[model samples]
Target chain A: MNLEGLRVMGIDPGLTRCGLSVVQAGRGRAVLPVAVGVVRTPSGDDLALRLLRLSRAVGEWMDEYRPDVVAVERVFERGNVSTVMHTAHAVGVLILAAAERGVPVHMYTPSEVKKAVSGNGRADKKQMTAMITRILGLSEPPKPADAADALALAVCHCWRAPMLFRQRAGLIDGRVSAAKRRTPSPDNHDRSFPS
Target chain B: MNLEGLRVMGIDPGLTRCGLSVVQAGRGRAVLPVAVGVVRTPSGDDLALRLLRLSRAVGEWMDEYRPDVVAVERVFERGNVSTVMHTAHAVGVLILAAAERGVPVHMYTPSEVKKAVSGNGRADKKQMTAMITRILGLSEPPKPADAADALALAVCHCWRAPMLFRQRAGLIDGRVSAAKRRTPSPDNHDRSFPS
Candidate 1:
């Protein structure tokens, strides 16, 4: 699978501030950042209105950028139930916007994203930001932690999507692919998917 | 402030099975059931696909019924974190669908629905189901719990929406309105605005 010229939008879903990043990547070439921004919704508004704002913003981004694929941060176990619910709600809107535009959606867990960008599953926020800055050749890490996480997610997808397609196509054995061989030996995002 | 003849679609958001019910209500008539059904999404499918299915279904219902307003059951604090997340995600999709069509969306809590329908804030499922069957003049309660809950939510909105409008219009004072005077003196759904 030649993944070159593939455009992907990575979304870190949050009700207050959702991070969105677009990256272009393929094999044997440096990934490039196309766009990075955050969609902010006022916490004082009604819940439905807050979600509607997110949905519209995501839809606008998809229409303007027209990415081939969308990668969203998978919501995982968290201490704040309200935060988890809000994140999941935002994620659904993101996925719906992409799906409505006939784009494929993939979810990557935080651990997988951290490991892919920083080579450590338990990497802290600062470590993840530093790695994303270096990976994208940016002068500095993106603003508001969420933006950096979104870029990391986009990069992770670019690095991992090809192997997933190959696995699905039965072109490679279930053990490992050439791309995995070149990358760090850590837990992969596409592995044990649909979490 | 005349909320009569308002058609409303009530939604009970769930990933596996989303219950949607439509009801017609006016100032001086019995609240009538317009439609009742459930939209089921296989748990085996991708999360995005499931939500897209739900989004499409809700969109279709909005187009066919053209409800003036949409009422969604607000997801509340629950022991099961995953369930709460899924419910909130589904609720987001429901609200987005309605909002896209220029429909007003409102949220009602479970206790409010129970009190509005059964005059008991802590009404059990069976008791609520019995009340719904009696109120809707149906032979029996709608099957699959979710469907019945959806109908209950719709009825709850029909009874509560009028007072909300009156309050917003300043036609009613701070004291409980005449409509609420007839019902239980428990907490009202619209009193707090949003949970």
Candidate 2:
């Protein structure tokens, strides 16, 4: 897969404030920032309404940026259960927006993103902000940690895209060979792809 | 609010299998079943794809059944963290679908559903199924524990609608009067409703 000119949208999902960033891969290891912002929803709103607002915001970003791939921060079970659940909800809507537009999506854990951006799995917010500011050549650090996290997620995916693509390709090839052994028909090859 | 002929759709959100059921509130405490089924997505599919499929399935149900309100089982952070996160994802998309169609969404805990259906907060699956079968006057119990749970959720919402409506109305009235006291402008009345 060609990585040149590839655009990626990264999302840090949260019900109250979802962070979104769009980054384009330039020549070599250079990455250009396209957009970075947060989608805020009032906590007083109903859950359904809040989710709907979040979905529309993400959908608008997908339409405006037309990113080739979307990267989302994988939520974990730690911290407050209610907060985690809300974050998971935001993730669902964000991912669905990408799928609806037929854009490929990739998810990375917090540790993976931290390691990719700062070379440390346990890097704190300040370190992450500093690294991202230096990497992006921005005059000021990204404000509201969520925005910085989104940028980090996009950078992480841009760096890992080649490896992930190769891994998927390898899996597809293995599945195709296994299918050929079971049946000598071309139709069986389609089974390799998830429906 | 008139309870007669009110339609309610209950969703038991899950990634692999999402159960959906539609029930109409009849005279008094009688409730009639309109539809019952489960939407199944293969685990092999990507999370985004699965979520998109779930969202579509629920959206189709909402269009076909035209439910006045949607009731979803409130997911808790228990058991496997991954499973809970998936369930929360399902819940988010499901709620967004309802909100997109302007249908109000309500959530109930597992215990609330059980108590409403079987008068026992700790009612087991068998008891809940039996109670639902009897209450709906169905020839047979709804198959798949998810379907039965969906039906119970719908029935629970139907029974609780009157109280819930009253509570919401009271809250709105109180907010409106409080807003009037703060600023006697009529335009501020809109603030009482969630934007």
After TM-score superposition, the amount by which residue A66's alpha carbon in candidate 2 deviates from its true location, in angstroms, is: 0.4
Candidate 2: tens digits of C-alpha lDDT, residues B1-195: 669999999999899999999999988778899999999999898898999999998999999999999999999988988888889988989989999999999999999888777778898999889989988989999999999999999998988787666556757788765655587444222112111
Model 1: per-residue Cα lDDT over B1-195, one tens digit each:
566788989998898999999998854535788899999999888777888999999899999999998988887657587666777778778888987888998888999998888778899999999888877789877898999999989988887876676667544464556665677745444332121
Best by lDDT: 2
Can you give the lDDT of residue A45 in candidate 1?
84
Q: Determine the backbone clash count of candidate 1.
A: 0
lDDT of 2 by residue, A98-185 (tens): 9999999899999989877777789899988998897777989998989999999998888778766665675778986565557754
Q: Which candidate leads in TM-score?
A: 2
Cα lDDT of model 1 by residue, A53-163, tens digit: 898888898999989999988886565877777777777888888878889999888898887667688989988887788778899778988899889899888877766
Q: Which docking category, incorrect, acceptable, medium or high, applies to candidate 2? A: medium
Clashing pairs in 1: none
lDDT of 1 at B86: 71
TM-score of each: 0.85, 0.87
